[model samples]
Target: MLLETGSVVAVEPDGLWVETIQRSTCGSCAAQKGCGQSLLAKLTGHTSYLWVSLAGRSADDYHIGDEIQLGVPEEVVANGSLFVYFLPLLTLLAATVAAHYGIGREGVTALAAIAGLLAGGALVRWRAYTTRHDSRLQPVLVDDRQVVQLVG
Candidate 1:
C-alpha cells in the first residue's frame, strides 16, 4: 500500500477532496545535471500537487481545517498501469500477425493495423469497466494511526 500525506480541501457529507503533494524524480535522475528537464524542474521546485475527490469516506470525523492522509493499494496501481501499456501492445502484435496471415496485400495490412488499434483501445476500456464493477465498494479512509511512517 502507498500512503500519501495531504490536507482536506473540501468536504461533502460522505466524501472529501484532498490536495496531495508529490516529489519529483528529476532531482534524483543521473542526467539532471545536464538535462533541460532537470533545470526546469529545479527552477520550478521539485514538488507537485494534485487534488482528487475521494468518495465514500466519512467526512464527519474530519473538519474542513483538518489534515488527512490516504492509502492506495499497490494492486490497484499495478493493474491500471499494466492495462494502460501492455494490453494495447499485445493486442496490436496479435492483430498484426493475424492480418499478415489473413491478407498478404499491403492495403489489407494497413486496414488490419487500424482495426487492431481500435480493438485494443476498446478492450482496454472494457477491462477498466469490468474492474470497477467487480469492486462493489468505494474506497475507504485510512486513519492517521494506520499510516506507516517512512524515513528518507
Candidate 2:
C-alpha cells in the first residue's frame, strides 16, 4: 500500500474530504540545484493541494481537524499508470502500421495515428468511469489515528 497523510477538510455523510500538499521528489537528488525539474519546482512552489474523498467512514467518525492516512494498493497504481500511458502509444503504432500498408500515404497515416490516440483516450476514460466505484481502485482511509507528516 502507498500511504499519504492528510487532514480532514470537510465532512460528508458517507466520506471525508481530506486535503494534502502535492510534493515533488526533485529535492532529494544530490544534483537538484542544477536540474531543470528542481528549478521548475522552485519556481512553481508547493502551494498546490489535492483534495480526495475517502469512503467507508462517516463524518461522525472523524473530526474536521483530524489527520488520517490514506492508501491505495501498489498494483492499482501501476495498472492505472500503464493504462493511462501505454494504451495510446500502442493504438497509435497499430494505426500507423495499418495505414502505412492500406493507404500508403504519410499524411493519412499521421491522421490515422491521431484518431487512434483519441480512441484510446476515450477508452481509458470509459474504463475509469466504470471502475470509479470499485473499492480496490479507490483510496481508503488506512490509518485514522496516525498523525505523522507525509514525505515525498
Candidate 3:
C-alpha cells in the first residue's frame, strides 16, 4: 500500500473529499534542471482532491480539516500508467501499418493514425468512466488510530 496523507475538504454521504498536495520528484532527479517535467511541475503546483469512500466508518467520525492517510495499490497505479501511455501508441502504430499496407497512401495513412490515436483516447476515457465506481480502483482509508506509537 502506498500511503499519502490528506486533509478532509468536504464530507460526502459515503465518503470524504480529501485535498492532497501533488509533489514532484524533480528535486531528487538528476535531470531536475534540464527536464520539461520540472518546469511543468512548477507551473502546475499542488492541491488535487480525491473522493475516498469510508469502508464501514460513519462520516460523523471525521470532521472537515481532519488529516487522514490513504493507501492505493501499487499494481493499480502501474497498470493504469501502462494502459494510458501504451494503448495510444500501440493503436497509432497498428493503424499506420495497416494503412500503409492496405491503402498504400501517405495522406490516408496519416489520417488513419490520427483516427486511431483519437480512438485510443476515447477508449481510455470510457475505461475511466466505467471504473469510476469500481472498489478495486478506489483508494482505501488508512486509519491512523490503530497505530501505537512508541514513546521512550
Candidate 4:
C-alpha cells in the first residue's frame, strides 16, 4: 500500500475530503535543473493541492483539520498506469498491422490507426466509468491520530 499524509478538509456522510500538497518528483531527479518538467513545476508553483476521497470510515471518527493517513493498493496504481499508457499504443499498432497486411494501402492504414486510437480511448472511458465505485481502487483511511507533541 502507498501511504500519504493529508488533512481532512470536509466530512461527508460516506467519506472524508482530504487535502494534500501536490509535490513533483522532478526535485529528486539528477537533471531537474535543466528538465522541462522542472521548469513547468516552477511555473505552476508548489501550492497546488489535491482533494481526494478517503472512504470506508465513519464520518464521526474524523473531523476537519485532523491529520490522517490515506492508503491505496500498489496493484491498483500499477494496473491503472498500464491501462492508461499502453492500451492506445497497442491498439494503434494492431490496427496499423492489420490494415497494412490485409488491405495493403497506406491511406487505409492511417485511417485504421486513428480509429483504433479512438476506440482505445472510448474503451478506457467506459472501463473507468464502470469501475469508478470499485472498493479496491478507492483510498482508505489508514490512521487518524495526531502526532504526539513533546513538552519541554
Q: Compared with the true structure, what per-residue lDDT tens digits does model 1 show for residues 85-132? A: 887777777887888898878788777877877888899898767766
Off by over 4 Å in 4: 23-56, 144-152
The candidate scoring highest on TM-score is 3
Report how far off residue 147 is in candidate 3 (Å).
Answer: 14
Tens digits of lDDT, candidate 4, 1-152: 99877777788776677765334445676887886646766787743333454344456777888877778899999999899878988888899999999999999999999998988888889998998878778777676544335567
Can you write out model 2's per-residue Cα lDDT over 34-145, one digit (the tens) per residue? 8665576578773333345544344567788777878879999999999999998888899999999999999999999999899889889999889877776877777534
Q: Which of the two candidates, 3 or 4, achieves a greater lDDT against the reference?
A: 3
Best by lDDT: 3
Q: Between which residue pairs do clashes occur in model 3?
A: none
Instruction: Write down the TM-score for model 1.
Output: 0.59
What is the lDDT for 64 in model 4? 89
TM-score of each: 0.59, 0.71, 0.78, 0.68
What is the lDDT of every predicted structure here? 0.64, 0.74, 0.84, 0.75
Candidate 3 lDDT for residue 79: 97
Check candidate 2 and list the clashing pairs.
none
Worst 10 residues of 3 by lDDT: 143-152
